[model samples]
Target: MFMNIYPKAYISSLSDVKADYFKEKGIKGLILDLDNTIIPWKAAILQPEMADLLKGYQASGLNLCVVSNAFNRRVVGLLEPLGIPGVAWARKPRRKSFLKAMDILGTTPAETAVVGDQLFTDIWGGNRLGLYTVLVIPISKKEFFGTRFVRLLEKFVLNRLAKKGVIEIPE
Candidate 1:
């Protein structure tokens, strides 16, 4: 169960991700979590740095799609100008939305990766689908109420993974 929830990589933020690294790993597509992963939770604006990075990834030939639990309006508001496709109210940790994102990318699991701030949703869901998972620290402390509860459990799991050397926790 723990292995199933473990992420392939853990990083401070999305800015750490490099298109070249994914290319080397044969990942042609990216399934991204929108809220706290790309922007602050519930934020409609995409930061200039993040926007540039995402554009850079596209320029590097990586297909990208946002799979978000937020409402359709929220997702559309943020991604439309960028011309990125997305699915809203994804109910992730479930495989359906993840599969749908892959279909949109036209890439198989072997050629895809998932990047998000949540372990239960993003990491576990992506791992279940056999896609590489990269867990990033949430961009802000603000999030859904339910997510706060999940974060408690996530902390425990992260600590355990760190002690077992499955991953090294950042100080």
Candidate 2:
């Protein structure tokens, strides 16, 4: 289970992602998590730096799809202007929604990357579908009660993986 949740790379933030490396590896699509991954939980829009990075990535020819567990209105309102496709209430660690996002992005799992701050949801779901998984530190410590609970489990898994020398990145 721990191995299944191990991310290919752990970085401080989305900006740390080496887009060229993923592009070189044939990753052509991005399955993005909207909240802590792109902005703080209550943030209304993307941060300027984040917006710049995402726009740059898109301009590089990679398609992006937002796959978040947030309500449809929340995700849709945020991604609408970008015209990015998305799936909301996308129960993660489940294959269906992830698969749907990939399909909408027109890429197979092998050619896609899933980016988020959670191990159980983003990493597990992406790894389950054979997509490259990238884990970024959450933008803020604030979280809902359920996510706070999951974060405890995520910490345990991350600690174990670190002890096993799997998570070597400095984040």
Q: Judging by lDDT against the true structure, name the best candidate.
A: 1
Q: In each prediction, how many residue pairs overlap at the backbone (N, C-alpha, C within less than 3 A)?
A: 0, 0
Candidate 2 residue lDDT tens string, 30-122: 999988999898688877788788888998888899999888988888888778887999999899999999889999889999999999889
- The residue-by-residue lDDT of candidate 1 on 63-116, one tens digit each, is 999999889998998999899999999998999999999999999999999999
TM-score of 1: 0.92
lDDT of 1: 0.90
Candidates in order, TM-scores: namely 0.92, 0.89
- Can you give the lDDT of residue 131 in candidate 2? 93
Score residue 15 of candidate 2 by CA lDDT. Answer: 82
State in Å the error of residue 119, model 2: 1.1
Among these predictions, the greatest TM-score belongs to 1
User: Which lDDT value does model 1 have at 18?
Assistant: 81
